[model samples]
Target chain A: MAFLARIYVTPRADVLDPQGNAVAHGLHSLGFGEVTEVRIGRYLEVRIGGSDRAAATEQVTAMCERLLANTVVEDFRFELDALASDR
Target chain B: MAFLARIYVTPRADVLDPQGNAVAHGLHSLGFGEVTEVRIGRYLEVRIGGSDRAAATEQVTAMCERLLANTVVEDFRFELDALASDR
Candidate 1:
């Protein structure tokens, strides 16, 4: 099976996203008034093959935890789009 | 006001995303067979104050170019979900 996964990796809410904040501040400096906050995150689209949707989901989830996302300060969520198993 | 902006910053099609490739290789190592490709990107949620939608779009576009995205290697698209003007 092939799937289109949209993975979002965000700084845990309790963890401040300084990179995001710095960008926001920079925006303020560039005259974008009242830019309050910016939350930065990562997105990934991966093509995977599995026996079934659940199996693919499991594989992708493990892939995320092991390599794609850092669980310490970042949180991740994925939306799975099951495509025909052509490839 | 508040907005939920989904910003996608992806490597230009011609540019290689080594970090993404590395992660995919790691997935293969971990037994997610036939995983073809992985493209990584950045997403952002921001809060901004603008006179109107057009103004907000312009401000956010500028923000993406000046600070949020690396135009040389990356291409970005943003979806703006406008909220009520209470804030």
Candidate 2:
């Protein structure tokens, strides 16, 4: 079976996110006073072929550690869905 | 009430994504042959204060159009959850 993994990589809470701060400032200037905070991150969609959900999760986790995410500065999470039948 | 909106902005399918292509190539060279394609996008978390969900949705949508997303080359979707009690 094939699986599609949707991963989100976000900077650690303690990290300084200048881009996010800039966007927040822009929003405030535009009169969106209700919008208090904005944080930006990376979204990734990865397609993989595997025999089962467990195997696919293992593969995707390895990919995250090796290439998909930088654990030192970012944290990652993902959701997997079977895609063979949808196509 | 307060709500948190999680937004994802992705390049339109017809548009060219050089960054995504570069990541795919990098993965291919790293021996992940099962990985077929990769699409990169932006993930954003917006914290908003409002009295109701419908009103909050309206505000968030307007924010997306005005600043949160670039409607020309990208498309966006969001999920909202009330956050008043979480704290």
Measured over the true interface residues after superposition, the C-alpha RMSD of each candidate is 1.4, 1.1
Candidate 1 RMSD to the correct structure: 2.2
**TM-score of model 1 relative to the true fold?**
0.86
What C-alpha lDDT, on a 0 to 100 scale, does residue A17 get in candidate 1?
90
Whole-model lDDT, candidate 1? 0.82
- CAPRI quality band, candidate 1: medium
Q: In model 2, what lDDT does residue B37 have?
A: 74
Error of 2 at A83 (Å): 1.1
Q: Find the candidate with the highest TM-score and give its number.
A: 2
In candidate 2, the residue pairs with backbone N, CA or C atoms under 3 Å apart (3 or more residues apart, or in different chains) clash, namely none
**Alpha-carbon DockQ of candidate 1:** 0.72
TM-score to true structure, per model: 0.86, 0.92
Model 1, range A1-87, lDDT digits (tens) per residue?
Answer: 578788888889899898888888887888877687788989898987655788778877888898888999989999988878774
Candidate with maximal DockQ: 2
Chain B TM-score of candidate number 1: 0.88
